[model samples]
Target chain A: MGETFKANVIDHFNFWVAVVLMMIGLYAMITKNNLIKKLIGMSIFQTAIILFYVSAGVKDGATIPILEHHAAETEQVEAGEHVEGHPVANHEAHAINPDDYSNPLPHVLMLTAIVVGVATLGVALAVTQVIYKNYGTLEEDEILAKIKAAENDG
Target chain B: MIWQFDIIILIFLVITAVISLRVKDLLAASMVFGTYSFLICLLWAGMGAVDVAFTEATVGAGISAVILIATVYNTRRDSSD
Candidate 1:
């Protein structure tokens, strides 16, 4: 049992770390009273997820997704020798195996996610600023108490 | 991906995450959180996602940290809980 656990830990180390980080972020978001701390937690959670996706796309012994061309091939292309419409170059491109490159889909998806996360963080911080302006405190409980007091007075 | 490098970074990542949450000072927490983001960016770069790492460094570490520090400066810096 111990050996199996060790093997699993070794094989899926990245996934395990991502899960741990995610839990830490969730804990902060749930337990913290400070609004900015919660925002930081949210950012941590988002980054953990991005890490998970990017790691999932990793290929063993594979290069990045960009295709490399030999100088001879480039010179041939530039000389218009391989300009026989779509067939020749396409055939040459197809000759390269897909498995030689890491999967780019997850990376592309996470790029959008990272942008969205940043935008969300910015918006949340702005809202936090507004909250502070109105209540004069950044603590959640204080804001809640003030709101309740206002409600009781009204 | 070198396992040794990955393990070291992952360990630091978790440590930073915990410290950022546990720190009482808001500015310190924001700085630790920025460190956490930068560590994750390093992890992504090690995994061969250069573009993702670049974006994380700029947006997550740079802009997010700046915004967070600005917010912390504008508001109360101490946490009650």
Candidate 2:
């Protein structure tokens, strides 16, 4: 029981931490009305997602698949195939298996996600600025009151 | 091992829900919500859902938060209290 503690504890600890962070971020977004604080919440929420992705993508001791020309080549020296005149050694060509490489799918997906995130953030910020200009105050209640008054007057 | 991870995630989830309910400041509440999204994303990562994680990070943390905040900006600064 004692020996299995590390495996039982460490892995669970990381998972729990991520879950907690997510919960906190989500709750804040739903109930908070302050604009800046909302953005802060947004940032934290986004960061938590990033952390999850990284945690899931990491493979133990996996190397990124960068293709090296000679790396795939295998040297097969025949018993008496050596010739003094030839500068290059003759090795039979061997087929390469694609399974030995790290996965590139996640990286590609992440790149797109990152781009989309930034674009969304920019648009949201612009909208917020506009709202601030029109409402004078950024509070939800005040905006509601103003709208309510306008409705009542008309 | 798998069960442990699930349990951990579940516990955080509960805390987040409770905090969101108890907090007074709407701004603070939103911030906490965003944090919740982030935590879920990390959980996806741990589960070997790299693609899902990427999507969640952007949609959950990035876009969703922005939407809420932008909406917030349209309103009053002070809470109802």
Candidate 3:
């Protein structure tokens, strides 16, 4: 049982770390009363998720997704010889093996996610500013209290 | 799998996170949050996700922290709660 636990720990260490970070972020978001701090926690949570996804796409000793061309085929071209039908000269003619590269799909998807996160954060901060201007405090409880008091006055 | 380095970085990340949450000063929290984002960027880069790391560095560490600091500047820096 100990050996199995050790193996799992070794194999999935990144995931475990990511989860711990996520929990920390969740704790901050839930417990913090300050609006900006909550935003910080939200960013932390988003990044932890991005790390988890990026780590998931990793393979042992895998290179980047960029396709590589064989040097031998390129060498002949440098020798002042145009080799007809040479796959190296025509990048589209060569089919790359998917196994050679780290999975790029996650990176692509997370790119959009990161942009969206920034946009959301901007909007949230803008709203927080508005709240501060209206209520004169950024604390959730204080803002709620102000709203309730105003409602009673009306 | 280079687990040792990852463990060390993650430990620092958690420490920064906890510290950010515990600190009463909002500006200090924002700085600590930037450190957290940077650590995650390193973690992503180490895991072979250069593009994601780049995005994290630019968005999480750069823009988000800056915007938060600006907002903090515009409001109260201390939390009453």
**In candidate 3, what are the lDDT values of residues B1-81, reduced to their tens digit?**
366888888889889988888889998888888888888888777776788888889888999889989999998799753
- Compared with the real two-chain complex, what DockQ does model 2 have? 0.12
- Model 2, position A14, has a per-residue lDDT of 53
Candidate 2 per-residue lDDT over residues A9-127, each given as its tens digit: 66545545656666666766776665545554555565555545545554544444455666544333332234444444444333344444446565566556656665666676677
Leading candidate by DockQ: 1
User: Any runs in candidate 3 off by more than 4 Å, and if so which?
Assistant: A69-97
Q: Tally clashes: model 2.
A: 42
Over B20-39, each residue of candidate 2 has an lDDT whose tens digit, in order, gives 44565655656666676676
Q: Which sections of candidate 2 miss by over 4 Å?
A: A1-5, A12-14, A72-102, B1-81
TM-score of 3: 0.85
Top-scoring candidate (TM-score): 1
* Candidate 1 vs. true structure, TM-score: 0.89
What tens digits encode model 1's per-residue C-alpha lDDT throughout B1-81?
888899999999999998989889998988998898899889888888889989999998999999999998888788875
Q: Scoring each candidate complex against the real one, what DockQ results?
A: 0.84, 0.12, 0.71
Clashing pairs in 3: none
Error of 3 at B18 (Å): 1.4
> If you assessed candidate 3 against the hidden native complex, which CAPRI class would it receive?
medium
lDDT: worst 10-residue window of model 3 chain A: A78-87
lDDT tens readout by residue for model 3, A9-122: 867877887898888779878988888888878877887787788888988778776655674455545444334543355543444556667899999998898999899999
